[model samples]
Target: MAVIGSVAEFTAEEDWEEYCERLEQYFLANNIKDTETEKRRRAVFLSVTGGKTYELLKTLLAPQKPTENTYEELWQVLQNHLSPKPVVIAGWYWFWTVRQKAGQSVSQYLAELRRLAEKCQFGNFLNDALRDMFVIGLLDTAVQKKLLSETQLTLDKAYHVAMSHESAVQQVEEIQGASKQQVNKVKEHRDPQKEKGVISAEGHPMSQMIVSFEKSCVSRVVTRAM
Candidate 1:
């Protein structure tokens, strides 16, 4: 809610006051126990914006060059000094923190994405992640049992791993009564198998061996990426 931007030059006089009010409201909205830590974070956030928000304010505020990191240097300072961190760490922080406060529902995050898409950077990632998380909740048993079985738990997972994916969600269908569409979607996004041709030492076809080899390569890629 804190409208971080330059003070003396960039922000309009009225907008600065509005930003301060929003910042206060945002902190109150969180209701977290770390009031003291949050205060320090907020202070750093304000200090940075008050000084640096103007350097690029003309470009950011102008219609032609609305760049996202209008306060990049300030953000660096806040991330370094704050504990529990302020909502200025990354472009995604505002949406992520708001999701945290709103019970961490997939629906809630999606709602935020809808709002953010018009104004925020990395909007694509947030929307994609939220949709994927919902699809996973629909199909995966472990996901359902661990996160979705309960409202709050599901909400929490929605916030933390809204963008996470399980590699095998696609191929198998009908896992605990999930929709076929969901399964198909997972399969659609996942990487296709790159089959290494199966040939025995004698130059005979070895279909099973080829399948095994491809699976091994895919597994290794996934493991290393993780």
Candidate 2:
């Protein structure tokens, strides 16, 4: 039999929702079945969550023992302790105030918007809220204008348009930067005066011209003398 993947122990700094998601995936991968009462699953969770986490869970449960609880009850207890639901108004305040930060990409901004929106409890209007926030929060005025100009714009469409615009802008900058570098290299290799006339062995253009003229005069005088 192949070795099953292991789950990492949860830490205080980690997001409880994300950690639970990964834990569920690990359970699925290992083919650990949860009985109707979730006994097996509950036992596995307690064993795999590490000593410190189990101790924390015991503390959260208080007078109740860990073995007395179902898996769902255990999960809920830990979740509520670690990640209590935020107040709706406070969540909205953050969601409304968020903007695309400097040096942050469109994708990163979108992820932040989603994270903040989770607490907002937008429900059915989630997509609409996300779309509006995404457009207004954009740092690029051109991309914002493009999104606003669209008729009946959905969140999906807006995301596609914004990403496309971001990609195109990056490509143009790269191309222009490369072209400028090539032009500079060519300029460095070329000497305008040398192209027009030969430089003197002494490496001066005016001196070369003067020397040629003097040589010409001397040759004519010598021919006349002859």
Candidate 3:
């Protein structure tokens, strides 16, 4: 049967869990079922894994040949090699101490918390742990207070509330900034007119003083002539 999908060579830089998931999907698409002889699936897996990965697997299997192991065994061995489990205590410490960094948005911070929580083994308490960490890590005091005031806060609720608060603050700042600019423009527009009025008022008084001085001089000259 023709295969419907292709699997790329697994690399050290790639996530092992994600790659495994994709590989399983490829198997399903191609009608490669476990009910068939284990040998067929193993051969198919070994063939498509590429030379570099096969060589690594050969080195890992060592004393035994790849053919001696079943498909499930080979997959398990690679999983153990590629994705070693993290220490639970250290993972928990990192998860608890993490805070929302400056310039990071609420969603970005939430993604980081989820990533750290993967190794924490929180099990059934995962959502509660996430919600608590999210509230503690927030840089916005108002958002923190709002979340804290909620009686039935879940991770979903916290995320939505924080996002809404952040959006509202940005909109308010934009409006206030625009208002200040408009006020300054109006003041600038009136300033030239005010200055011109002041100049006209001062000139009128100066012209009257000059006329009075001229009249006094003429009167003095006439009296002297008389």
Candidate 4:
């Protein structure tokens, strides 16, 4: 079948299993099957590979213009070259050392942790380890509390609770900020001395002082006219 957008090109840095799955699925959907004639299958396989993959393909096909081969041979060769033996150690180091950065959202942080976990491939040990790592990496203590308080937890559930709690906290903080701004605006318009109820030496209020000043101005005008 013809594809609409281009299929994703495999890169060395990507998850090996996921990349392989995508390629295999593409082949399966397009009828590039194992039972098919080698000539047609080989052409389709070559069409999909790019970047460093072509180099691997050439090495596998050397001494002859590879007119025929199964897609599985190409798959194995790419996996052998792309996925190194030492990556397990490096993946563990990264997973253990990973911490959530300040201002990073919970979703983004958890997704990163999940990727590192996949690299380790620690079997059944991964579940609780992932859960614990997520809680440990959270930047906010309050959200951490909410996450840990759950009696039975999955990473998915914990993420939901923490994200909702964070949203609620942010909303409350925004409301308080808006309220504080309104109060500040009111105070900005206020007369501080009058609000403090300070009286003049003769015990007249400030309003009387303004009226007296007006009367004095009128008297001065009449005297000038005379």
What is candidate 2's lDDT per residue for 1-226, written digit by digit as tens?
Answer: 4738888788878898998998888777877655753787898889888898899988988899898998889999998988898899999999999999998998999999999999998999999999999999999897788788889999898888878777766655565565456545554656677654654233444444544655565555434422
**How high is the CA lDDT of each candidate model?**
0.43, 0.80, 0.81, 0.69
Candidate 4's residue-wise lDDT over 1-226, tens digit each? 5753345666777777777677667767766666655566666666766656676667767854434455667667667766656578888889988999988888899889988898888899887888889988888887787677878988777777767766655655565565456555555665667755664333334434544654565455434422
Q: For candidate 1, lDDT tens digit of each residue in 9-108?
A: 2243334434545554544555422645655544544454554453444333455332333334434433343322324345345434443233354445
**Whole-model lDDT, candidate 4?**
0.69
Off by over 4 Å in 3: 177-226
Best by lDDT: 3
Clashes of each: 2, 0, 0, 0
Model 4 misplaced stretches (Cα beyond 4 Å): 1-19, 60-68, 146-151, 187-226
Error of 3 at 34 (Å): 1.6
Q: RMSDs, each prediction?
A: 17.4, 15.3, 19.2, 15.7
Error of 2 at 178 (Å): 1.9
Supply candidate 3's per-residue lDDT for 83.
86
Q: TM-score: which candidate is best?
A: 3
Preferred candidate (TM-score higher): 3 or 4: 3
Worst 10 residues of 4 by lDDT: 199-208
